[model samples]
Target: MLSLRRILTVSATLGILLFLSFFLEQRLQAVAFRVVMLSGIAVVMAVSLNLINGFTGQFSIGHAGFQAVGAYAAAALTVYGHNRIFGNLPRSGQLPDTLQGFLLGAPAMICALLAGGLFAAVVGYVVGLPSLRLKGDYLAIVTLGFGEIIRVAVENTEAVGGPRGFTGNIREGIYIPNLTSFFWVYLMVVVVVVVSRNLRFSVQGLQYLSVREDEIAAQAMGVNTTRVKVNAFVLGAFFAGVAGALYAHFEQSVSPTSFGFVRSFDFVTMVVLGGLGSITGSVLAAVVLTALPEILRSSLGAEFNQYRLVAYALLLILLMLVRPQGIFGRGELRLDRLFGRKGGGGPAGRDNVEDQPAATELR
Candidate 1:
């Protein structure tokens, strides 16, 4: 059952945010809203990717591949569906009830997300089947190749506009009047974070950790390492797909280059910098990393834009020098730890003191 009190609390908070977003003429509101959206997306991407990279210790740089699949799948359904049903793409200004009903119904968005996730999972299975046999750098190379292949495939696919890209009306021209509001994005992010937290504490998540720890030993202990690893891979792909769908709709554009190796590196950098297995760390790092680049670009302008990359490079070097294990290392950062679950390994069931490989293990 939904908690009425919690719902009301959230609603009230969101109402305030919406007012600030709409009413305030200050540029700060725009920046804040963008930050919130970016943070939400980052949380989704980081947490889901964590399932494979952090919990399962998989070396998958194909994160963006799944995202691309989801983005196109969702964008195509809405854009094509509207054109087919209405005989023309709904323009932004106004729309008839037929299109409005179709677009405004939250159910369509949910369906699109499901389609995206399922498609990405299918791709995950196909990719994982061949690549899982490899190890370490070999696995990373295979996943990297997979990402490039996805980009190439997207670039050549005329249905989605190939390299030219695709853009059309989203929301069926309903002028839905603030459908992508703060509350919606915030709720999605919160749900994702909570679900990830619960999954990390579940039996399957423990199995993922077992695989990460030692595949041979995990297999000896009756864990189906292959299934466990694939579960992480597919599940992570699903969330990545979801995030991509959200981003596509938010930006109202779809491009193959948008979901390429550089995007994958951004995600990996967030996970590695935060603490591979630490959910809290991932969320924090994602928010910081995503915003930092934009902030630098804004403040420094084109003249200093290149320095932003240098800054990140220097930060990476410093992180390696100071603590190669990462800020959290194998340690998790859950509120539960402060209370009593310390060393319990919230989801993975490993001893907190156990030595685990560094994020460099993926590289």
Candidate 2:
């Protein structure tokens, strides 16, 4: 079993290589590095959403709203700063001559990412406060509505280009550097998975499960259900926002369409297909889902466009029928249990199970 410290060290080393690959002058190396960065972004999204949808047992469809906040926040800052420096957003395929210089020279870009995350957290707080009152489909509906509200709000906001959307010639931040590589993204994904897996085993994570299982029982046991729920939602939103920021810069564009309700549903589908409470499942689902479309696009070219979604829907339906609990259910899918830390010990540990009462003497 790799200790947490050792795992982190390995991740850091890989990240360094990915970051440096951007300047390697090798096209293959650069493309590989960018793929890693994207994988990392996906990891961030999957892990964060796992907290609320998996651990906390909440059915939220507002994950994309947080991502939007992050993307716009990062994109806006990049554009504004680029305008300040180069007089406009850079055009496609252009590289900044200063790439070899200090990494993270654009400090505002990092700030934008952080700000986007914070803004998403704030939104989480507001939406979670009320929606937490409901359960099951009711809760899902409320969150779905929240997601639509965010999309419409962004569409109406003129400051950010409103409905038409905004595109900026922005560069990736140096903290990561254009050195964005596959290994970097893959490493980051590994980090998110590791962190999330650890959290699921921690004591606080147990509390989350308790709440997820039975609010009344958890409250009886002195667990603060409200706090647990809010924390899950907010923290998940924070990471989603960060992923959004990374995505915005990676794509160098921001639009309301990118964060529509369908996007939120996609994340939910990943969580569901992966298993409602399995970290390993989430990771697997994210990779499969993210790559599926790209694979189809590559293989079928433009002709496969309409069938892509049809395939997605069919896949979802098939999964539900074959494995209603998802690929992992409340369990994780790890090859070596000995190498990993023990999680919360299955669904039975949750507080939701009811005890049968003894028969009365009179009866």
TM-score of each: 0.79, 0.78
User: Candidate 2, which segments miss by more than 4 Å at Cα?
Assistant: 1-37, 81-109, 169-188, 335-363
Sequence-dependent TM-score of model 1: 0.79
Candidate 2 lDDT tens digits, 1-363 = 999998999878766755654444344454444444565677678878999988888888878888998777766655555546433223342345344322433354456567668878888898888788788899888888887887898799876678977664324421212322343344446666776777666667777877777778777777778888998898898888878877775665678998887788778888888888788788888877776655566668898767766776888899989999888787765434546755565675422222211111101
Alpha-carbon local distance difference test for all models: 0.71, 0.69
Q: Backbone clash tally for model 2?
A: 7
Give the Cα RMSD of candidate 2: 7.1
Candidate 1 lDDT over 4-85, as tens digits, reads 9979987887676555433432345566667667677777888788888988888887788888988888777666665453
User: Which candidate gets the maximum lDDT versus the true structure?
Assistant: 1
Best model per TM-score: 1
Model 1 error, position 74 (Å): 0.7
Worst 10 residues of 2 by lDDT: 354-363
Clashing pairs in 2: 32-182, 33-181, 33-182, 34-181, 36-182, 36-185, 104-174
